[model samples]
Each structure stands twice: as C-alpha cells, then as structure tokens.
Target: MARNRTRAPSSTTTTATKTQTVRINGARVKITTKAGKVTTKPALPLEWELQAAQVASLRRLPQYQRQFLLAGDMNASKRGPRAQAQAIATGMTSGEPDLRIYGEYGRLLMIENKVGQGRLSPAQKDRHAALQRLGYTVLVIRATTTTEAAEQAVTAVLEWLAQEKGKAA
Candidate 1:
C-alpha cells in the first residue's frame, strides 16, 4: 500500500472587484481593484483643502508671494460655540472672503473658494456686494476638485494682474 500523498495548491488569479478607502493629505479617497487593476481618485475636496491649494499655487508666483493674505477664520463654526462666540466678540466679521490680494495702486481683489455645489451665504453675498460697491473685485470660484480650484484661482489672479497692468499704462 502506498502512503497518502498531498499536493500544494496551484497559484490562481481572482477577478472579483474590491474597494478601499484611505485618507490622503487629510482627504478620504476611494480606491477600486478589479482583475488585478486598481483605480483611485480623491474625494471632493473640502473648503480648507481648496483654500490651501489656491494659496500654495498663488505663492508660487514671485509677484504674488508677499502680496496676498489668507483669512483662515472663515471656518470658525467648527471651533465650537464658545470659540465662535469669542471670535465674534473680538470683531471677527462674518462672510469674510478667503483671500485678499493687494495689487498695484492699492487695488484689491478678494477670492472666495468653494467646491462641489457650494454657494455663498447671505452674509457673504451682502459683504461681496458691499465690497464690489467700494470698487473692490470679488470673485467666487466653484470647482469640482482642488486642482481645478487652484487653476481657477491662479487664472483669476493673473487676469486681475494683467488688467491692473493695463490700467497703469
């Protein structure tokens, strides 16, 4: 009689689809795997993400490196009610734009960053209208992704700079 023999399992490929979620740069992204292939894309970027990207891109330009300011308190609502009340008590105005760029001849351009179905609040609308009335340019950029937001911000800034240059001539 022969002793029982055992055989090792053969290597095989599986094609069932799989998915995973991961955090990248503070954003949750979804990755898909099917038939040994993987695909991934970042989730819709948050307002802060868009703002950060815009600032980073703008600062890359020498002319704008020192001429821009970011109003980071726009998201104060997330800081809890006490902090929010304190901020308001300290003269933190509502509806402030995210970015302020000082151009030639003291001209001002304000940009409000938004992503994925975002809209300005009533306070923001009022503030923007008041700013526009004061001869300040206010732009609202709504994009689907961070890169697009940054590109739009850069393009708007470059156009504003060019227009200012033209007026100076």
Candidate 2:
C-alpha cells in the first residue's frame, strides 16, 4: 500500500494585511495612513507632460513663433456629438499632430509627441503621411518608459532645429 503526503500551507497569503508609507514633498501637513490594499494613478499624463516640455523648449528659441497645436479628440469630458459637429464646422480635424511651429524664413515644423506607452493613432498616421506627401516636415517623438527619455526627446529636437538653422545659413 502507498500513502500520499501533503505539506501544510505557509503563513503568507494574498489576504494578508500590508501597508506602505509614502511622504509627499513640500506638503505642509504630511499625514500617514495604512490600508490593506493601495492603488495609485499617475500624477500627470505622460503624453501631455512630454508635449509641454517640447513646447516650452520651442518657446525659448526665437526662430520658433506663432505655433499652432491641434487638440481634436482630446478632453473626452468636453467631447460629444454636438461638440464634434462644432469642430467639423470650424474646420478642426482629428489625428492632427500636437505641435506645429512657424519658423523664420518660411521654415515649418510639425511634431507628434508621445511618451511611455503612447503611440500614434490610425488617423494620426494617415495625417502624417499626407503631410509628408505635401512636402511638410513631420516628426514623431517617442520616449522609453522614463522621464529621462522624455527630456532627451525634447533636447534632440531642439538640437536638430539648431542644425537645420546652420544648414540654411
């Protein structure tokens, strides 16, 4: 005769109570709390963060001026059938790049800024292709899953602009 042997379960279980302490900098009153399970969302949207940085960089350079950014398909809370109809009536479009700059001497730049898990949507891809065919300069900037990548993308674009300036001169 053979008998089966079983071992007892360990003390650790998924239901076990766990807590983490996080300190927020620059807060006047830092209160600590503990809970069984904790969930979190991002402090800011990565795509927007990256785009703002790029826009700020462009602002610092004198050659970049009178830029226009497309904002269709953003702000879902403000989007509905009526709002969409108004957009179409006003000649607004979808999948347009997030950034556009009118540079000195007829030079123009168009950029789609993406960070972390962001990617160009189908409409954006088609817009980019159409813009390219029309001899417009279009660029897509993607960053790895980190803040440094976002910063690097901005720096690289600024550097490219500087190089293009040199070529024109």
Candidate 3:
C-alpha cells in the first residue's frame, strides 16, 4: 500500500490582528482588533478637550475665512471684507483665535467672530479670560451683520482702544 504523504493541516490562521493608536496631551493611547473585536485605550489629559473645543470653533468659520485664518495671512489687505478682516490681525495663531487686533499703541484685542447662533466654548472663554488677565481686551461678534452693525462694532473696539491708549500715555 502506498504510504500516506498528505501534509498535516496548518494550525496557525493567516488573518492578521490590526491596531490603531493616537497620543493626546502627551499620553499614549492604543486601539486593537482581534478576531474582529475592537477596543480603545483610555483617554489622556484634559488638554485634548481644550484642543477639541478649539478645533470645533475653527470648523464654524466659513471656508474662506478658515483658509485665511490657518494661513496666518488674513491681515494682508486684499479685496473685500475677508481681506479687510485679515488685515486687522496684528498677530494670528491657529492655536489661539481667528484674529488678534492690535491697537496703534500695542495693546492686543482678541476677537472671535460668529455668524449665527453665537456660542462660546469653555476653552474660548478660558482664552478670553486669560487675555483679559494679560491686559488684552477680548471681544466676540456675530459676523452676519449689516454694514451699520459692522461699523458700530469696529468703532466700539477702536474707541475702547483709544481709551486704553490714553490711559497708557
């Protein structure tokens, strides 16, 4: 009789276990999959919450404003209101705010513009408070304004700055 030459069946499975990981606020987090089972690691520091809030606020901006805000070139004079908005910022940073209006005398004013359903996040409130502590006046405005409202807001901000300038002088 011919000897049986068939190989023994393999014990190991060919399917691979996959994993994904992200670090938030300096803490390591991991996600793993095994046999189609998925799991997530624990949350990191509260900094992630703050970052998420900032990102959420950024997402609220119009696409063009968002682009200019990220590019840090909104302060450059261009064509229309968007260009004028960019031109107002003296120092802009994605980590902080949409615009940083600087007075002629060097005082800083951080402005957050909202188009509709104006709401301020905890992180934004914290930032505004911090700016106030640093002697910078912070203002929040609804961007969907008539030309008159826009003019009034600008005048109010400039007038406040003038008073601040007078005090410093």
**TM-scores, each model vs. reference:** 0.70, 0.58, 0.39
Q: Please provide, for model 1 over 34-141, each residue's C-alpha lDDT reduced to its tens digit, 9 standing for 90 to 100.
A: 998999987677788888888888888877646444444464357788998888899877887888877777888898877777889898999889989888889999
lDDT per model, in order? Answer: 0.81, 0.59, 0.52
Cα TM-score of candidate 3: 0.39
Model 2: worst 10 consecutive residues (lDDT sum) = 68-77
How well is each residue in 25-142 modelled by candidate 2, as lDDT tens digits? Answer: 6322323233444554233335665666655655565544432222212422256899879977986666777666555556557767676557788888898899889888877777
Model 3 regions more than 4 Å off: 1-95, 146-149
Could you tell me which residue pairs clash in candidate 2?
Answer: none
What does the lDDT come to for candidate 3?
0.52
> Which wins on TM-score, candidate 2 or candidate 3?
2
- Of 1 and 3, the candidate ahead on TM-score is 1
Local accuracy of candidate 3 as per-residue lDDT tens digits, 5-31 = 998899986557887667768665667
- Name the candidate, 1 or 2, with the larger lDDT value: 1
